[model samples]
Target: MENSAGIVKPQYVTFRDDFSFESGRVISSVTCCYETYGKLSEDKSNAVLVCHALTGSAHAAGFHRADEQKPGWWDSMIGPGKTFDTNKYFVICSNFLGSCFGTTGPSSVDPSTGKRYGIRFPVASVKDMVKLQKRLIDHLGIEKLLAVAGGSMGGMQVLEWGATYPDMMKTLIPIATTHAITPMAIAFNSIARFSITKDPRWNKGDYYEGEFPVDGLAIARMAGHITYLSDPAFNDKFGRRYSAFEGFYDFNGFFEVENYLRYNGYKFTEVFDANTYLYVLKAMDIFDLSYGRGSLSDAVELIKADTLLISVSSDFLFPPYLTEEIYDIMKYQGKKAFWYNIQSNYGHDAFLLEFEELDRLIREFFADRGL
Candidate 1:
């Protein structure tokens, strides 16, 4: 099945090995789902890894099937003549290790018990996810990636790629992400997790065989959606608009923003898994570039790739200050680093929404490098 852009369908690779988790647990086998665009060069030197954000899938560009309703998440920036131009680069995007999108996650079956892994799935870290992707790259016969780029949690993976396999990628682009998750970010994630666990349907993440925790998961998604947009953006877009329902003055159906959240929450529950959400959030919360290294500076000093850090000015969640900190450290360590702060009202999601600015920056950046 091909999309209008003629991008190929996603493919799967099952890695049979004792996959080790950062938390000292292991999974006997793992499967990675991925989609590739364009052709890999003869020397395998033209490959780019496009990492997806939280709730995103490996279908980064083009339609999944002829009748598909929506195009891939980053379709705007990743097709013929687009920013990442599939015509010139072999772009690969893979679902994260613990994502629900055809990857080995909590929803997958546990080979040992013949049941869904659920809460029993070992905790994973950003490093673990990068390690899995590294193996996938090797499986595809790519010696090194030309570039690795992403925003949000996907950006965390990009950073991990640079840190874990410093020589694996030639360039790194971490957008709207931090080297270490801030306390404020952790607090928000904690609230989301608590909301999920407190729901009766959660049943300690073992709700796979019964009614799923849709309510809790929806609520969590609602909370996260709010963080993705800035107050200014929200006001401009939603403001004090009232719902269209008759006598919509009640607490449940009054504000248009409230209804919008509810709609997104409902939509998320249909596509996302509760247990996978919990596990992935935990991974983001505990991520620290300096976990094993002595300090943030020390950790970044190990990066051999040229780095580009992009931050949204209105992003309160991952904040511009955090990305600035990373830039400072990289410059201090004499590493090749560049920083660009996008003046946008869309907050943390600006990287995904502000296509014109993003495309311009990316185009110029690559052109300067003769890509």
Candidate 2:
């Protein structure tokens, strides 16, 4: 990402001792990959933690190398004068646990067995991911954060941070996400995992020594790509277009939509691991801010930070109503809360593409608090 700040660097941190997962399981150690933008104040009071969604890495802004073609994922929202405004706040985006990125995950070596963790990796929750992030913040000696923000799966992490460690940050912004996964969402994830496991090449998540389960992962990605878009978006892009012939349904048949999904599906396999996908999806499905709590408002009571919840009008995977429920809960608790629905036809992926509105809303939110 060619931001005014130019290029950024990536780094990793490791805890070389036994770590406890939220599930009460133990891991020999843990490693986290992260990237930072801007400078941290001497008091460490200007820090902002930006959590990444599934399939996202630590590169939240700027180019990684001189020859890099793309900036970090949120380059537009996290640069000098941007919504995150790197000049004023030190921003951190870390690859969460159960990811295939530089973070220790299924692709990482198991210290006890000296092999890939794969399916043996302990199931981690959003809280677990937030705990690791808290460790990262402490590692940097940051006493408190100005804000914590993200979208989708990352949004869940944002919520986790707010409820689990509200004292750690001043504000939380979760966009296009829900406090808990709906049964419909869980069903989709289940099917995606099933596709991965059914592939013969998956080899029960032990395919590291052989050919990877590329086909299965691709199919999973393909199915996922559908939920990321709205009907209008699909119609606008590939309504009646054909990838093969103009108007013929021949033996070798295809449409622009099929080609697009197939291309994205196979392409994703190059960067993501199948097992990581399964593990992360499960974590999301099991995420419930009210788990063990009396009610949703009870979970909201734990959050001390200012909350900004943004929903997409066209998001079918995580509809606006789900996020509204959170807003309702926070309001009932008399907490400092704000909600916005971005009017778009891009579905759940709107958060990634709706930069203008996001930047405007977040900039104002930060400005009001003198962040």
Candidate 3:
């Protein structure tokens, strides 16, 4: 990357119109917290909308304040000369509808009752998230985006954007994601949800005014975090090492991995809401781009944008085969598509870590399209 995007501030916008959710439910009035780096071109054709993974905020790059210790999540791959190249593309990122990070979600107050939606919030979908994003894009007066890109759950939104609104963007980048969630992935999610629901403090998702379900939320984060890394990553980082060389017979003798996960789990509770977690996890569990479109190939046929599908070799959660099928289908249809498998022990999170390789591939893909 050439340089940073410098200190930037987040922006907020609220839409008072009714939002029809995929679950046949509706909510009136929602707000979005967003951030933008770089400037829009005169014709507004250079705008890029970047979607974030589960639990990610809208700060995709740059320092939000002068003394902040860390920049945005994708700082390495964004900015002036990175693949996203804020200098050339007006990059935007928004917290999804059911997110806790400065966006309206289960944690937000309901207009009807003046109370947090809690479990009363409608079930949100990847398609619903994309439709909300379309509103933000329209608010900015951009007719079409230069590209839509993200990883994990964010990638699900990317694919949805292509399938639901084929002419909205010029390119699609879906990294470490699947068109349809598998039974195995759903099983893990079920366990995570169970961990929360069984906690007495959860109180059927109405604990905002009482004891927060920190313990349950921590367990849920721990379960979800495991799927983000590979065994090799775990082994290399923690292995069988003891937390403090305590006795093996200590009964609670903790491994370094256990300590690590516990620390992260608790830390996550500091920033995220339990209800938001339940909602977003439910959204991911039901995400399927091919559903209601006849079949996978039929769904793919609706896309007009060029696609770049990225997968990680050790991402057993989503896996490389899922991405390969996307590539296979697009090619069989004579659609412009490219695929790359990053060989990394970091597993599904390789897309977030392997910045140099990712930049190269994205650079080439954009160049081929003369973007």
For each candidate, the alpha-carbon lDDT, in order, equals 0.89, 0.90, 0.92
lDDT of 2 by residue, 1-371 (tens): 43455788889999887879988998878999999999999888889999999789998888888789888888888888888888888999999988888888888999788899889999988988998999999999998899999999999999989988989999999999999988988888888898899999999899999999999999988988998999999998789788886446587688889999999999999988999999889899999998877688898899999988999999999999999999998898899999999999998999999999999899889889887
Each model's TM-score, in the order given? 0.97, 0.98, 0.98
What's the CA RMSD for each of the models?
1.6, 1.3, 1.2
TM-score of 2: 0.98
Ranking by lDDT: 3, 2, 1
- Tens-digit lDDT string for candidate 1 (283-340): 9988999998988888888899998899999999999999999999889888889999
Which candidate would rank higher by TM-score, 1 or 3? 3
* Candidate achieving higher lDDT, 1 or 3: 3
Best by lDDT: 3
**Model 1, runs deviating above 4 Å:** 1-5, 244-249
TM-score of 1: 0.97
Ranked by TM-score, top first:
3, 2, 1
Worst 10 residues of 1 by lDDT: 1-10
